[model samples]
Structures are given as C-alpha cells and as structure tokens.
Target: MNIAQSYEKPRWSADLCSCGDTGTCCITCLLPCITFGQIAEVVDEGGSSCVLHGCIYGALMVIQCHCLYSCLYRGKLRAKYRLPSEPCNDYCIHCCCEPCALCQEHAELKNRGLDPSKGWIGPPNAPPPMPPSMIK
Candidate 1:
C-alpha cells in the first residue's frame, strides 16, 4: 500500500469549543473576514492576498452563503494535512458555527507552526511542511 493511504492523520490540535486563543476567537466571532483571509493566504501559499479573500468572504456573508466559500478552504486545509472531518462535515461546521470553525482552523495552522497572522511567510527555500507521521 502507498504511504499516503496508510498514514494516520493527526487529530486537530485544538477543539472546536475548547478555543484556547481568545484573541483569535474574538476576531473570528466579530471579524471572520480577517481570520479567513489570513487562512486563505497561507493555504494558497500566498497565491492570493488575505485582503482579497477576506473581502470575498465578507461579500458572501451578504448573501448568507459565506459558509459555501469558507468550507471549500476548510477542505483544502484538510487535504493538505490529511485531517479528518471531525464532530461533523466542513460545510455543516461552517454553516452551524462559522466562528468556531474559523477559530479551529486558525488554531490548526498555529499548532503546525504556520502562524496565519504572519501572512504567508513560506520562504522559497524553507523546508516543506511535514505531514503527521510515525518516526519509524
């Protein structure tokens, strides 16, 4: 079997409700655009600007379907890290508790040493992101 198929994904470093970073949680609750934009910038590897994506997220909120957009990014993050759909699916999580999902995703990035606040500091020569794995 291929390594990808056999690899055991790591559990999210933070819980949906156990939000440890109150600052982020507040930002997510009050200004989700900022949080989502930050996350998108990193996830896209800076292919897109935070302001751009955040603005899009804010716009989608107007139609009350921002969850549609945000959930796609959640999918991207899960694909990148091989994360499981926990407690529920991405769309449901964002639809039911957008702020919580945003906070959890932000926490996930921080836990992986990729602080979204830094704004895509992925240097060209930096080591590639390491997926969770066993030492042996």
Candidate 2:
C-alpha cells in the first residue's frame, strides 16, 4: 500500500501531543546540564526525544557535582598545577573513561615535564584520536 493509504486511519498524527515528533523528554532530562546550543545541536541530529530513566547519559548529568569529585577523587586524573587535583572531566568527555591509547600516553607523559602538545602521541592541538567504528 502507498504511504497515504496506510495512514488513512492512523492511530496517531504528528499534530497529536503524544506523538513521537513532539517529544520533549530528552530536553527535559538533560535540562540542567546541557547548554542551549548543545541541546539544539543534539535535536538537529535526529536523536530520540525520549530519555530512558537511569540511563548512563542522564545519570552523568544528574550528579555532575558528585561525579566531578569522583573522577578527581577516585580516578585521580587531574592537573598538576593544583594542590588538590581538580576534576578534568566527569561525563567521559573526550572518552576520558574509555580505553584510549593517546590518553594513556598522555597520562604517562604528564608525569614528565615534557608538554603533551610537543609530543608525537597526540596532535599538537587535539585531545586524542578516537577509535574507528566497527561493523556488525
């Protein structure tokens, strides 16, 4: 059947408040953490408007203050300039939590006086190179 014929007596329409297109939960869940520009860009990318409760993304934003402390207190990935190491990232920004060779090398080099920007482990201006995607 053609698209129009299939929808002749549709269960829902985009105009309906309950319809998927008008969903606002993603924005609602990420409300306090994400900036306006970030939210707009994520929506523009066709991300689903529904956010699962207890999902990692939502959790990360929810306890941002605590996570920041945890990353510093537990992960111990902090800058040397501060006496009490400040949290570099809490939400796995730049895949900080994931296994990244560049980050590992950077961590090692951070002990030395050599600047990461002047090293071959990573590009002068880049944080680290992300791994390639795998096919199913």
Candidate 3:
C-alpha cells in the first residue's frame, strides 16, 4: 500500500495497479493520450478540451516524453484532491506504469462523482444542466 513517501494525507480509493475498470484499462493501454487528456481536462477545470489535450499528448509521443507531461497533471490531481504521494512518486508511477496510472486517475474521478466523460459542466455545486433546447 505504502510503497514510498511519508505524509498524512488522503489516500487513493484504489491502488494504482488495479486499473479499477476494464474498459478504462483497455483505453489506457492502447491509447494513453486519450486517457491523459481526459484527466488533464478535468484537472484543468475544463479550461481546455479533451480533444485538444489528447492531440498534444499524441504529438508528444514522437519525442517520447509524454509521461513527464502527464505526471504534472497527476500532481495537479493530487493537489486538488489532497492526495498523498504513495506507492511511489508520481514521476516514477507515470514513467513506469503510465497506462495503469492513467486508468487509476480516470477511475478516481468517477468514484468522486466527477465524470470525465461528461467533461466539465461547472463547479461541483453548480445548477443542474439546462435542457438542450434552452442552449440556443
């Protein structure tokens, strides 16, 4: 459980290696850019979009340093959630287990009632979404 680090902070609901959901694991394994972007969008409070971030991540693959970029989001996610660095630092986790790490973050967001699939609607306490007809 505590592979590394020392601090009293909120722990992840699930272990990083668990993948939490099979579908998430599959996506992360085959297309980690998608996973990373989804996480990044949520962490960015949806200031940017999943597609935009995903494209950037995919482009980073050519240089093979996408993991570092993704790691920064992991830090942001941790700060937002007040989660501690455990089972190793984010750098090591993303570098060594990028797929699993991405899957875990996606699962974590879902568990916390923040659906990455829906993108960012607003703050957690924002009013319910308006009907599509009202959006004109």
> How would the candidate models be sorted by TM-score, starting from the highest?
3, 1, 2
Residues 1-136 of candidate 3 have per-residue lDDT tens digits of 4645555557888788796788878888998888888888888987999999899899998999898899999999999999989788999998998888898889888888787767876666678888999998
Better of 2 and 3 by lDDT: 3
lDDT of 1: 0.90
Which pairs of residues have clashing backbones in candidate 2? none
lDDT of 1 at 121: 81
On the 0 to 100 scale, the lDDT of residue 42 in model 3 is 88
Candidate 2: deviation at residue 77, Å? Answer: 3.7
**Residue-pair clashes per candidate:** 0, 0, 0
TM-score of 1: 0.84
Query: Stretches of candidate 3 above 4 Å error?
Result: 1-8, 129-136
**Tens-digit lDDT string for candidate 1 (63-117):** 9989999999999999998888989999999999899899999999888888898
- Better model by TM-score, 1 or 2? 1
Deviating ranges (above 4 Å) for candidate 1: 1-7, 123-136
Pick the TM-score winner: 3
